[model samples]
Target: MRIVSLNAWGGRLHEPLMPYLVNVEADVLCLQEMVRTQGADADWLVYRDHGIELLQRANLFEELKAALPAYDAFFLPVARGDLFEGDRRFDSEFGLATFVRRTYPIIGQAAGFVHGEFSADGYGPHPRSRNAHCIRLFDYERGYPITIAHMHGLRDLEGKGDTPARRHQANALVDLIRQVKHEGDRLVVCGDFNLLPGSETFDILSSLGLADLVTSRGYEDTRTSHYKKQPRFADYMLVTSNVEVITFDPVAEPEVSDHRALLLDLK
Candidate 1:
């Protein structure tokens, strides 16, 4: 089985993102920073926040569903806000999404907020609401269940340091993992965690018997050339000890989004 996790950057680079989604051919795909605009006809929407303007796909969720017809897609919105098409305003949902290939039978699922609850109104402050989604699939070929969960972590304005809210978020993620995974299941957790390498989040996740594949494998950067930030590590993939990792690649080519895609293949 193969799993790919990426922060899609709201599909700002739609040209490459569209083909990447279709060509990656991952059995399971987890995406963060996805945008969905309901009842909009335009293909592009503008998102403006704190003087930062970005162009996003109007409804990327539906686009992915069309591109990968064989996958069962699931989306969990953390907040609802507005996107603009010229002067017209459209309501848009922002969150994470997971797409599983039809061959895998989804037998269990769970979702919960790791930070604040769902914001029905505009996105609040810097550290906005964040949530996680988990799905347990029965892999008949492997003869065992595989549990996969992902989240786009809370982004604090201050920095990506260890904060009280982030610590709470890590614990909440652990609880969510425990809720759906079974004893003999091969577990995988990943996403754009929005954290530093030395953060306590790794320590918290270590309690679950999962190892960080990014840092442990000596990967230094998870950001593409588009991101001009310093700490180029925001994404990670963690798996249980029992998982047979065939190959793990932090894909840096194609520059599909600002973030690099983490691809993992398992036996």
Candidate 2:
């Protein structure tokens, strides 16, 4: 199955869609930053043409049941900053969301946490950072696990570079794996994991056995740093040792949000 994972930055603008979503194809898509910032409703109709059903926010539980009967959603507590009303924190606040296709029903759900996973107060900043961070999708139908956690790096990792928070995040990921998964599961961790391969943050996932699909295979979606002048940041789509890595590429679409859409095709 060619499962595509992408973070739509936030629900602010149009997404960098893959050709499969538009044309005739059957595939699974995992999107982060699908937030409902405004009132009760969000701009969900945008994905209608994509031939996929988006899981609505938790508030619309009844609507989800009546409308799409196939999928349901679970929200994680995301930390928000007062500076930016909609902007989320690095390690705190916000929650993980899931949109599962019916071919595989969601027989169960879990959060990849082990108490003080980040340990914000124990490490660097007291408040810690949080965004639409990350999540793991558990498919009981297939008895496999797909992790959608966001390994995000900050704007300035230079000054606060040597702190333990970053390592804590990685360590927490390792611990999460032990808590939420078994050896037989096929793990795919994808999101805005800030640092690129070889960086400390990357090492966190890599050291734990998650391989970078972009570098391992040759799916260079677009130029890096989609948030910068050249868009060269390595917001990755990583996979575990079990799955066969196929293509890892970021869509060459214009920046809909700050980041571009990254993809990973696994076998």
Candidate 3:
């Protein structure tokens, strides 16, 4: 399977990213900070043109209610952030969101999108307190199937070592990982975990038997956040036990968001 994960930057994108089909896309996509209020056209366009299902909200949740009538929508309200790392708020003030392909019925749900309290602090002076989104995806139809955990955590905060919040933030996701993974079932975790390969969080996930897709292929894990020298490898496509990492690259064109798109293929 191949997956593409991005923060979406904001509610809107440039002309290039507006009609997302023109750009490289994903079979299943997870977008964060989508500021689509009720009846907004952002997700509607994806559904209209590409047939991708969406799960999100804007000023109100009415549009989500109507767009996805078959399945109930879940919201992870944006709250305060842990001050330990730093303080940065979502530009859209939205939480991480999931849009299950309408074809797949959900068997489980997360507590909410917001991991920790999000302090309304802008970046610059203090470190930015960032959290990630963890969504567990299941394919139960195949007798038994794989479980996917999608997340986007904070990266590059100055005081990461001193704070327990960053580690605690991943507790829920780690718990989800333990519960969903079984002997026969394959486990895959993707999305922007926000930590670099050498970071403690990355090591923790690795200790659990997960391998970074980019690292295994000998492809430099860089590219995602524009702030990095090269493209940063904050976004990840990791597999547990072991899975093939066929291809990984930043999209060549149809430039979607400010962050370069990372693509992954696996057997």
Top-TM-score structure, candidate number: 1
TM-score of every model versus the real structure = 0.99, 0.62, 0.65
User: Whole-model lDDT for model 2 versus the true structure?
Assistant: 0.47
lDDT tens readout by residue for model 3, 42-144: 3322211135333222332333334445543454435322111113212323455555554454444443321445545322223334334444445445334
The best-first sequence of candidates by lDDT reads 1, 3, 2
How close to the true structure is residue 137 of candidate 2, measured as C-alpha lDDT? 53
Per-residue lDDT tens digits for candidate 1, residues 116-140, read 9998888778799999999999998
The per-residue C-alpha lDDT of model 3 at residue 34 equals 46
lDDT of 2 by residue, 105-135 (tens): 4433355442233332222343334333334
In model 1, the Cα lDDT at residue 228 comes to 99
Which 10-residue span in candidate 1 carries the lowest summed lDDT? Answer: 117-126
Error of 1 at 18 (Å): 1.1
Candidate 2 vs candidate 3, TM-score winner: 3
Model 2's TM-score against the true structure: 0.62
